[model samples]
Target: MNLISFITKHSQLPVKGVENTVALLNEDCTVPFISRYRKERTGNLDEVQIAAIVNFKAQFEALEKRKSAILKAITEQDALSAELKSKIEAAGDLTTLEDLYLPYKKKRKTKAETAIKNGLQPLAKIIFGQRNDEIDYEASKYLNDAVPNEDDALEGARHIISEWINERSDIRNLIRRQLERFAMITTKVVSTKKEEEKAQKFRDYFDWSESLSRCPSHRLLAILRAENEGFIRVKIEIDDDKALNNIENRLIKANNATTPHLQLAIQDAYKRLLYPSLSKEILRSAKEKADESAIQVFSKNLKQLLLGSPLGEKRILAIDPGFRTGCKLVCLSAQGELQHNETIYPHPPQNDSKGAIKKISSLADAYKIEAIAIGNGTASRETEQLIKRIQFKNPIEVFVVSEAGASIYSASKIAREEFPNYDVTVRGAVSIGRRLADPLAELVKIDAKSIGVGQYQHDVDQNQLKNSLDTVVESCVNTVGVNINTASIPLLSYVSGIGPKLAENIVAYRNENGAFGSRTEIKKVARLGNKAFEQGAAFLRIKNAKNPLDDSAVHPESYPIVQKMVKDQGLALSEIIGNKEVLKKIDLNKYCTESVGLPTLEDIIKELEKPGLDVREKAKVFTFNQNIRTINDLSAGQLLPGIVNNITNFGCFVDIGIKESGLIHISNLSDSFVKDVNEHVSLHQQIIVKVLEVDIPRKRIQLALHK
Candidate 1:
């Protein structure tokens, strides 16, 4: 079968769409470019569909590389039989390929390799043939003072056959499959260690075990953490007798002359060759699967966090809370322009509260601020209260934004560009305000992993987590169009085809030549290649473009079609925009072509209905209690309103006005079998819940979404 073609057929996208997009993506076309300008080229695949195809293409390429390496390694060892070569070539998984390559792989000298080198090849073959009449004679022919008696010669022959059994890829594959099915992961606490303070949470994990398939990612991560911290040892175990029986049923015969000899050989091979290797492989595979699952969970949470309520182009007062160092106050105008910057120490500006209030009020009244965005870091709540105590009849609404990566962004090159005249802390205040204005655009300036909404995010494979987060960010950026005039280089870089250099070029071109007149003008940016232009143009919207539709997310490719639709309706672009009747008459199917499909056409039509619509909703004003700083504040069955910080396969974590969020396990989701935690709750969702249990010392809070 044609592998790429086969994958395309099963994939969510059209075969030609995936194939053509992969080709372009491989040749350096940016995802945004292909998604926006190359609609006709890729059958109108959107960024999400195109990204999926690119990932699959990378996977297939990696698999092909591994296959070639396996084939070459075996052929070089002269162990490549015609049938074996064919089987190895046909194999898909790494596990199966490794199985086929086992015998050919270079290894440390073993008993079997030594015995084979001792000139007992013919005798070993004779004994394997299992001709009862010749077995004893064959054994006798090989016997010597060095070999001892018949039993000794027979034993030597068994060793060779055992090695062959171990070498058989089919046997190894079968055994691995069986172990995966029957094995139970058993975790144990190391009683040997004199326990330290931080290792206490893991103390209970030292002697815990669960089925490999059923183990939640968080649980596995916890156990792995304990092991790393030297608090426990973990192992996976299965019944060896049952495992042997399964193998014997497939590879050994009961009534042949070689039966006893084969059993001995097979048993030895299982111990010497297969079991240890397969165990390690299985554990590694499980860990990788677990990591991927967890990273995906992290990615979802991060995406939600990044796309959380935009402060909606409203002027905001930003406070990067500090006590001894004084607060960094920055005011961002509705258009994200830095209107004013200053510092006020409500806690210590020489312990002068009157002066601090006067300064804060002066900045607020000067900018006519609609709300205050306080970074939820040190002294954040105190800062919020200070702002709230002010006597404006309709006081500014205050929100506590997660400041996880705020400092990182403040110290970044992008931050330097936004605030060249201020300190890092002031830039952080600006970030907090901008984050309230548009989280996705601001968070992209910081590393996704640094956002800290994930479980064992640091412990998992770093490269894998990065790739997943990158995909999520790319998807989010494309989904929400960037303001070409207002977008920073960091936000611009994530557009489908644009990289750091191209992003800088676009910004430089804009700075040098003034604001972009239209999305098409991005072509003038230095080093902004055709591929980059195609992916990035549509997403980089110009609010006051030469064409009104350019401000809307209607791609350049769909412009002519939309223009025709507007003309046919006898309505101007503004007249029909946000009008349901006129939009209903615009046939989405009429625009469908080999390059543009129903999905892209429909999406374009919707974007036209609400031009430059902020995809994120406004987060509600949640009043958190000061009393519940930690899990110890909660009792069983106690009710509390909280924010859903994260959702994983096993459960959801709710920040119930506490330091440690409570877990709402999957079982408690609906009093029914909850297969996926995301189906019930999502990141940053406001939820009211009851605390089922709280182990203060362990810092484990079990919560239920019963309300």
Candidate 2:
């Protein structure tokens, strides 16, 4: 299929409109530019659709390049047939084409090549043909070969015939497919060194066997961990009888007289060559699949963490906990405005306890703070204790905010813009406070993977991990929407059409010209262009501003239509926005099209149903154990309440007031079989559990779910 048509057929975007979009991207036009101004040309494809087209187009071009490479590789061997060349050229994926080319590709010297060079090719062919009862005759024909000095020429011919069977691509392919189907992955301890005794985590993996599809990512990763630590040698195995019989069936006819010898040769080939090669391929496939799965889990956790609710329109004092260097404190106004910044050494400051207490108390009093946001960092708990001791007449609530990616955000360009004259440490404190106030907006500023919300995140494929995480962020950002006027560059950057550069431009424009009066006013932002506005406008909110619908998710293009709907109800836009009667009367199909479907229209209707509503409310605070600091402190049968930080295929990790989270295995998630942990528990969910077991030295805590 032609690239544009292919994209149209496969993509969730408008096909015909994206053609021009793709051309612009190919010409190096940025997403921001095309999404904003070229709406009429693209039939109003937003930033998301435009970006999808760009990605698909690049992939299409790469496939063409791969096809050319495959043809060149085959043509070089002078064995390219018209039909094979056409088939390879038409192949969509590399794996399919590679399977077709496997036989003809250049290879290392094999026994068949040796036999061919030794002039036993004729005898080898005769036996491979499986002719009627002619094994002895075929062996006699090989007597003149250099190895013919052996007493039995027939035995020599058998060896040559065996090599031929091994070299046949059809035979190898049949064997590989059969083995993959029947194979069971076997993981075992190497037992080569005493190191495994010290590797307690791997002791349980001494001899684990799992079917390919049923093998979970975490389990595979565990075995890989053992292998990396030099504690285990892992293997993939197929039933020997099944594997051998499949190969024999393909190579030897049932009525053939030489079937026994062919079976022996096939068995020998499998032992010498096929088993090792196919085993490695299976392992590689299994690893790739496992990595994909792990990346998905990590992506889900990161997304939920990044999209955690924001405490909208609240003044906050965010403190980044520290000891010798001292804690950095920054206060933000109710509108996320930076009001004050300072440093306080709650520990070792001026070597006086009274002075440290006075410093933080004064700042809290001056800021009229409602909540004290303490960063969960190196000296977090100590900082929490310090805040608790200073019991104000106001009795402010203390929240231990995760400071996972605060440092990264603080050093980022957006941070520099937000706190131009402030040091990175000072910016970090502001970030921590803002995170408490608006977790989603503040966390979006940091890299999703760096959020520390998932298991083995750093070990997964970074690119795949990044893509999955970005998708989650995109979905979350779009779902919640952003305020165009108040959103930071980092927050705006993730909105539909708006990206890093465009988001910066919008923020800079706002800084230079003041708050956006209307979502349409964003067009004035330098370099934002049309594409940026089209994608971003629908997501950005303009509170209590001109055109009340602007504060809602209803896009500017759909504003008139909504107004028309409201007018049809004999009312103005504001009168009908929150009125259930007016909303019920509106038909989403009136606005539905190939570009903006019923789903998009329904979302707009829902937004209007709750106009200018703040999505973030106080999420239920999870209780952490007061005594437990880590897994080592836990014992069996101890019940604890903790926040569910992440969920995976095999288990859910509960941060039970400890540095290390305890795992509730899948079997424990419910009395029934829990196929997916995410279905049972979500990120930030509070759960109670009983400690099933804890290995003190290993620092592993096994937990069981509480009803």
Candidate 3:
């Protein structure tokens, strides 16, 4: 097969485009680098398109490997023929490949092998041909040594015929299709664990049955989890009569002398071999599909969370709110460096309310805290209220940041290296503050999964999840662009081709030699060679650079073109930067070249229009309904404002100032039919929702968007 052309056809991209993309990918060109810098070569394919090509290329390579193994296995058996070779080569998917190799695959001794050992092969072949009239006499003739009677000889022949029917690829394929379309997924509570408290959480799924095709991703994940926990039994099955009828129609050639034997073989094959095997295969494939869907949703949510609004570089006072242990507070510099730390007990127990207020006010004044970030943990609401009651010398923007992964980050190796002198609480407070100042920068320091916003993340394919989440982080970082001078090692690591080691090198180089003055200077970082620099430079923003475009997203390779444009227009490069009027005057077509087409040229023009622009909107304060403090405080028909904290396939969880977030089901997302919950709300989206149902015993709250 012409793999390049096949990939091009499957991806629906131009042949030349896919060819060039594949070439670049083989050359180790990163997706962000190719999409941003090599637009002309890829026909202006975005990151998503380039990644799809990468995935397809990997898939094709895997298929080729599997085909080679099958060919080798069959040839070793001395059974490889031109027709068999052609079939194996033409096999499209794994299912087909496995089906074709099934007859060749080695297995333990079965009834069929035993029957063949006892000289029932001739009788089996005669029965399959259906041309024999004296089948009983023929069976009696073979019943000499091992075969004692006609019944034994006939049963052995039936076993051999069953194995033959099971090996036919066409029959397997037909039955697989039927299973995919008509399989029913049913679950039942384990008899012994039915009344367990943990099992009650999965009560809805305990005695439920649904068509596998109609099962939603979230619901399927839930059922699988219940089954995995041993609280419920799960089974996938289809109507046997229908399945058998279809299989027989495809296998049985005619209704003749051997018709009864063939019918018996077909029934035995389906019941004993086919159904069990195909059912598992169908369920496994369905689960993988569901996993992909859930992972996509998770990747989207992680991207949004990582790219949440940045408050820019501001001196932030962060508090990891607590009651008995006190609110661990730390003041962070604009660059996210820890300057001071303290503990204030403002809630309950040590209600050193006066001292806490005075201490907070003094710290805000001394540190010149621009924004106050309180980690939304145990005593977040109380801490926010405490800070609000006190007056600072300057206007301080108070933000209750989601401390989803703060604790994890606090105890992490990255956090330890950054704050060796401080403890976990101080590190956590710093994370909260840094998250408020620049979410993308601080959040990258923690594991993507630990940051939350995924359904059954642990249950999905782990390696696939990591790769996907990493892609999302890379995309978000490149799209927003990172300040090289201020970015953490983790944030820098996500910038295009910069891996963990390169990020550390960049940080070390900065530490040794102040800050980067130009994008060109990045090459000085240890091991950040031409290729890595070429892939990474455009995404890393160097503020106060000698060249204005260096601070912008325009690649350094395109600097000569920008200079030419400025020279032709009789203007300095600075005059063109951020001057939309001057940028509009220059014709982008004039700058387009063979290597740099209209796509890159237009992008350069856009960058010149708003040089060094931060694409993220400014962070705004979100307030939860003050009347409600916890889930127990919630009531039916109470309308309250909340922030969308986590979104899943079923619905989004809204944080209405409590530990238990209310879930707004898909049906309640709008008065109309909402097919996708994401279409109605997004992560960190602030909106008002009316309380629909609050089950105090189960600690579940159902919410609906106000009509």
Candidate 1 lDDT, 506-598, residue by residue in tens: 888888999988877777788877766666667778887778887877767678887887888898888888897778877777767776677
Candidate 2 lDDT over 487-518, as tens digits, reads: 87778888877778888888888889888888
Output the better candidate (2/3) by TM-score. Answer: 3
* Candidate 3 lDDT, 1-707, residue by residue in tens: 66796687678888888999999998889999998889899888889999999888988899999999999999999999999999999877788899899988999999999999999999999998887877888789888678899989989999999998899988888888898889999998899999998998899998999999999988898899999999999999799999888987776777666788789988999999998898999889888998999999999899889878989889999999999999998988988888999898888898898999999999989999999998888989988888889978789899999999988999999988988988998988888998898888888888998988979998899989999999999999999998899888988989998998999999999999999999989998899999998888999998887888888999989889999999998989888788888888888887777888888888989998888788888899988877778788888999999999998888899989988999999889987898778898989988999999999988889999875
Error of 1 at 173 (Å): 2.5
Number of the top lDDT candidate:
3
Worst 10 residues of 1 by lDDT: 1-10
lDDT, candidate 2, equals 0.74
Model 3 scores a TM of: 0.98
Q: Kindly give the stretch of ten consecutive residues in candidate 3 with the minimal lDDT sum.
A: 249-258
Per-candidate local distance difference test: 0.79, 0.74, 0.89
TM-score of each: 0.90, 0.83, 0.98
Give the better candidate number (1 or 3) by lDDT: 3
lDDT of 3 at 598: 87
lDDT of 2 at 81: 96
